[model samples]
Target: MHKQIIFNLPVKDLEKSKAFFTAVGFTFSQKFSNDQAAFMHIVGDDIRAMLMTETFFNSLINKPVVNAKEGNEVIICLSCESRAEVDSLIAKATAAGARIPHPPEDHGFMYDQGFEDLDGHLWNLVWAETGV
Candidate 1:
């Protein structure tokens, strides 16, 4: 059984990407970070993301990298404890140069807000309480 999971995404600038995510309330593990890639910690579990440069990422895969700004490649969704947390994270991301792709969604029990990171990666912040 696998105990940990990691997702890889490409970024043009490692320093800039790290700064952006840091301002948006995310942390990184310097042990896995290098000139070619950075390991971003998702905060709770062993789930981490490797932010690799396009050149390095290409070396690992045999396909053309997609321009995330033109079209989204994936939407990374995160669950928050409350609606305030969802709103706060989105606000922080936006303040850190992320764009709000759309308006926040309120489904009574579940609330969602999202933004596109500096590298144009889509991230959805969702909040839902028990017995809401």
Candidate 2:
């Protein structure tokens, strides 16, 4: 069996988060979704992020939820096939309600852009130049 990674994130509204992710080109597995959370399938068997309601998350853990907006505890980085793919995802994410946290950065060998999801989770979309 192939190993997969699922990052669980707390959201204020499950439906809204679902809509946002869908608009940004992510498909969710309804089989894993319920009233409290939606499992978003990203990058086919490689990456996924679970959108869970605060109440549901609280029920699972005793620690307080980190306020992603106030401070980022983690930055999810996704590698892309090309620079255009990185740019396309950033534009799509922005149109889908994500806020661009920084201008696209070009590092000669790699290109990257940053955005904050509706719940303030940080995501870095990147592509590396093959010839570099």
Candidate 3:
């Protein structure tokens, strides 16, 4: 069985992507990063995101890369410890130049908000009451 999941995403600018994520509080594994790609740490070693330069990413796939801004690629949702944490991250992301596609939603048992990264990748920050 697989012990980890790494989501690969293509970006227009690797350095800008790294800075944006850094402001949102995501750390990278320097050991896995280089000029054309970065290993973004999401959940320790269990989950991760690979931000790759579009040219480098295209070389790995046969299909043309989707332009995230013009279309929906995938929404990466991450669980947060609390609703406050979700809001905090959203605030950070927005301050770092991300755009909010919609307002935050709260359902008593769950709360969620999302942002569009520089590369237009959609990411949702969610918090759920434990044991739900």
TM per prediction: 0.94, 0.94, 0.97
lDDT of the candidates, in the order given: 0.90, 0.90, 0.95
Off by over 4 Å in 2: 130-132
Candidates sorted on lDDT, descending: 3, 2, 1
Q: What would the per-residue lDDT of candidate 3 be over residues 1-132, giving only the tens digit for each residue?
A: 999999999999999999999999999999999999999998888999999999999999999999999998579999999999999999999999999999999999999999999989999999998999
Q: Which candidate is the best by TM-score?
A: 3
Best by lDDT: 3
Model 1 lDDT tens row, 1-132: 997779999898989999999998778888889999999888566788999998999899889888899997679998898899998998899899999989999999899999998889899999886876
Clashes of each: 0, 0, 0
RMSD to the native, candidate 2?
1.5
Per-residue alpha-carbon lDDT of model 2 for 9-115, expressed as tens digits?
A: 99998998899889888999989999999989999967899899999988889999888889988999998998999988888999999999889999879999988
